[model samples]
Target: MNQGGNKIGGADSASRAKTRASGGGAPSGGSPALSIVIPAYDEAGNVGPLLEEVRREADALGRSYEIVVVNDGSRDGTDRALDELARGDARIRVIHFAANFGQTAALAAGLEAATGDVIITMDGDRQNDPSEMRRLIEKLDEGYACVSGWRRDRHDDALRSFASRIANRLISKATSLPLHDYGCTLKAYRRDALDPSQLYGEMHRFLPVYVRARGGSVAEIVVRHRPRVVGVSKYGFSRIPRVLADLALVRLLFKYRTRPSHLFAKVAGYLFATGALVGGYGVVRGLGKAPILDMPVLLAAVLGVGSLSLVGIGLCCELVMRNHFYVLGRRPWRIARTVNLPDPAATGMVSDRTAPTKAVQGHAPL
Candidate 1:
């Protein structure tokens, strides 16, 4: 992560000085007990009021809190607005991306930068109500590693809402983590429950699923959703394909993340069995009166070749998966600059830390 932003405010300078003096632990004061992370993209008109609402709710919590906002290379004045917000408030931290790296990347950067024991994530468009934060935190306190938000009364258009319902059902069925709203970003997580390295390509929405897979308890609550009042929606029907693709990836990881060859080997076994049966029939006929180079023999040969190819591919995938477990330096997002944050190296971004593998209560390992 690069730290090369043009400095603008005295508050940011003062916070940086305090962080440096503390040796990247916490600022002059104690570390925040809560960290709210919001990812913004072209939401210049929305984030300002959103942060104000967050501040109000955070202050009401009576815990030391910091708001970490990631500017996702917005062409609008979103960067300037975030800078202005961070300029005055020492608790507001702004991370600027080199370019638009999508919401997952932005969340990854914010999670890496967050120093709180409890972290909450929400949208920047102000559709998620700040008043609902207390409900999520209370649920988190009930021995749950994750508390996801369910937008029961969604304010989106009918078509989008229907699409969201279908997507949520499909994701729930595929990942086996039944939740009403997987698309909602208004979720709270324990700092230890999140592994920022697993985030990429719209995987932010699957955080609860990932946590559950790692044996962390997850709970969902009905949250209030308001209509977008300022900026345009960043998502649309175009994201449907991407959502489906990421869902498939999630299913694959859930079932075969540790042993991918088993998945491939199962399919290959069926192909090989069918080919052998056909080849046996071909040989039986050839031994009687049929020609050796018959259609059954040719079909069997094709299936046999395909089975062998699939087995080879499975082996290659196993090797790739093994290597992935050993290498963790490849991150999906790049940072252009940061305000009121220490270097990424000191924040465990490149550390050897791994997620907890114990199973959560009432959930069996897949």
Candidate 2:
């Protein structure tokens, strides 16, 4: 079946509304609770509307849910809008960053504060329809830890559409996780399936890869994509080179993160073999009365030393990686604050959730 651009038409609207109206009842045991984390950057106009839509849909689902809108240092009226919204509704919260730390950082902050059985991530722009969240959650019930949205009928310009297609193909090939659309942020993830600490830079695009690398199953569903209602796209072609560089790093991390020696082993072997061949050729030529200080001899000598040096560098890298993982135990994820989190003691379970604090600059709590 062609899974591309399966639009929800008018006929489906009545059925969808019925399904929604039937929801908002008491959640049964094993029902998937949700935490919708939206990262907003200068999206003042869309912030309030997005939250309202999410609230309506999430409440209709009859699941315990919270909408965490991370204000990514928006210079606009986004902060004011979030403050007014959060003051009235306890289910809505905001995390105000000290500066514009990019979307990935904003997402990392939101994931840390999230306390739900399942976390939903979407763009702050209204382009990602909230109605499709039900579809993602429905697919998540099929024993998949992650459900990514595919914008089959994207509404962007031709250049962006073409660039996105190329980027998706390259990322899928590099990560070995074939996804139709990696740019869509509308995805549902199991609470324990991923570690937010492993994310950095624009690595949010590789969330599916990270989940799969941890042995978690992933599925994709076609979701409705709308044109932007406000603001401009922060991304451009200039970011492609950065994405390509990050893709290479992600590939290496996924392949040999746990056993880094696997990455260096083959390279080391090749380097040593090349060195041996070049040195051996030089020695063989010497027996035929070839000049010892000839260009071939010097070049062979350089190649031999270079190979040994590369092997040494590889060993050093392996040790550094091992020490960092075993000795230091570094974790990259951080949280500024949380709201309405369940009490661990009353629940008879302790979580990695940190203590809450107010908004502040630096690594200060909240």
Using TM-score, give the best candidate's number.
1
lDDT of model number 2: 0.70
Q: Write down the RMSD of all candidates, one decimal each.
A: 11.4, 8.6
lDDT of 1 by residue, 1-366 (tens): 111111111111222111121113443358787899999999999988999999999888777789999999999999999999999999999989878999988998788788787889999999999999877877676567787888888898999999889898898888877888889999888776677766777778999887776657777888889999997898988888777767766776778867877877786787778777876776766645765455666665786777667645654564464345325454555667788777555554432233323322222223
User: For residues 87-179, what per-residue lDDT tens digits would candidate 2 score against the true structure?
Assistant: 888878687765677788788767866777778999999999998877777766646778889998999999999999999999988887888
Candidate 1 Cα outliers beyond 4 Å, as residue runs: 1-29, 269-328, 345-366
| lDDT accuracy of residue 39 in candidate 2 | 91
Model 1 pairs whose backbones collide: 215-360
lDDT of each: 0.75, 0.70
Clashes of each: 1, 1
Clashes of 1: 1
TM-score of each model, in listed order: 0.75, 0.71
